[model samples]
Target: MWDPVTDAYVASSDSGAPPNGERFMLYALSQRTGLPSLPLTSIGYVDLIDSSAGAVGVTLVGTPATGPPATYARYCVARGTASVTSLVGFVTDGTTRLELRVRTDSTAPGTLSVQTAIAVAGRDVQLSEAVTVSPAGGDTARMTTDLRVTSGGETVRATGDVTVDTTTRIGSGRMTVSVNDGAFATLTLGGPDLVVAAEAGVTLTTADETTLRALFSTSFELFGTVRVLFTPVPLSRASPPVDERALVSPEES
Candidate 1:
């Protein structure tokens, strides 16, 4: 049955048995249908499944509704026993893609593992990190990430440690960047934007400065902070009424 209020399809088994044994599932779909679409035009789908182990698993996929159709998929599984959860996902927009995997277990508290990869414009970046969560020690989590970025020609890499306060939702980290196996700059994370500083005793050549400007921006040297922003895209056509909802749940005049 389609529930417009929830924007999901709900299905249940017909067998006259207890709900515990019965199979239940839901598929939710989301799409923008108006004159103006968000800067990132996308549609989303979510699938919720009930397993015999009494655990619910979710699979979500999203793609651009318009433009080059590139898809992203996310999978998450929660086990009834051991309170273990695993998540794997990938996001891509034709030119760029990011893959992430995470695993956590309540049975073994204060430990988590994360791995990520990014591919963009012939460049590849990979990161692996372990996080330690301290519930009593200031309610914070600390992680050290080893990152490597490589293209067909030059290679860049970084290493950083980030501390996140779970309660305050604030994070602090500093990453030292190296270009072609040479020290380049350091990036500090915590404030509204990213702060960049040159590595001590490292002088940037003209080519190095050009590379940095190309990677960051022309204002990379003038402004130490980098801010990323996005703007919405307006649609030319108006949205049509959702007639499918009436087939499931009729509206009163």
Candidate 2:
């Protein structure tokens, strides 16, 4: 089962190989325009099994490629409205490349409708990508765009945003905050505030201080904790000891 709200798989079952040579059927269903729509896949053959309960269905067994361009397609057989022999679908096990395109419809101050589109499963489909609007003025500024991945009328991935900030020029802008994209977390540098926003269910970590420093300056205000190293130096020897400065400057000595 798929959870439309969370965009996740709820429960699943697998019947191994239809119990030795028993023929079974398979069906693939996807969403099309707010309804169940079928996509293009390679399903060579399928057979149906009728049960005493008046239900018709088939068991799905075998592993498919897990990752990018992958989608959840219901693989099952149905006899009629009240009799679905077997109800099963894809339980994805890996990541997919979710592409998002964002642009504003208008630059006027009121409510700039930022448009967005997400491409998944090798198909370009329309999905909402508007999270927040950009601040309007003669000068350019940053805007945040949110996205939710949906397929066959079910949300596959939850909502997230891709924000563009510091629009210095037409092509000279950086993503301030973004989520759900397959790319690395967004990196924002300004006003002494350093923010790192990773995709949902993903944790952000730096390998070492050098890597962190490269992304943020020492004075940056990080939202989380970090490891700091402090070196200790031995106290100056009792007395004035030797004057190394006078040694280097003979005239002063």
lDDT of 2 by residue, 1-253 (tens): 3344554434336353344234432324465544222342323223234443433343323334453333322223222232111222222223454443333233333323434444554555444444333433444333333444455655422222222222232212223322343444554434334445565665667663234334332111110100000001111112211221211101100
Candidate 1 local Cα displacement, residue 66, angstroms: 8.0
Q: How close is candidate 1 to the true structure, as a TM-score?
A: 0.46
Model 2: lDDT equals 0.32
As a whole number from 0 to 100, the lDDT of residue 119 in candidate 2 is 59
Work out the TM-score per prediction. Answer: 0.46, 0.23
Cα lDDT, all candidates: 0.42, 0.32
The digit string of per-residue lDDT tens for model 1 on 122-189 reads: 44554333323223365555545455556657777666665555545455666677878888887676
- Poorly placed runs, candidate 1 (over 4 Å): 1-9, 12-44, 47-71, 74-90, 94-108, 118-136, 189-195, 203-253
Q: Which candidate is the best by TM-score?
A: 1
State each candidate's clash count: 0, 8
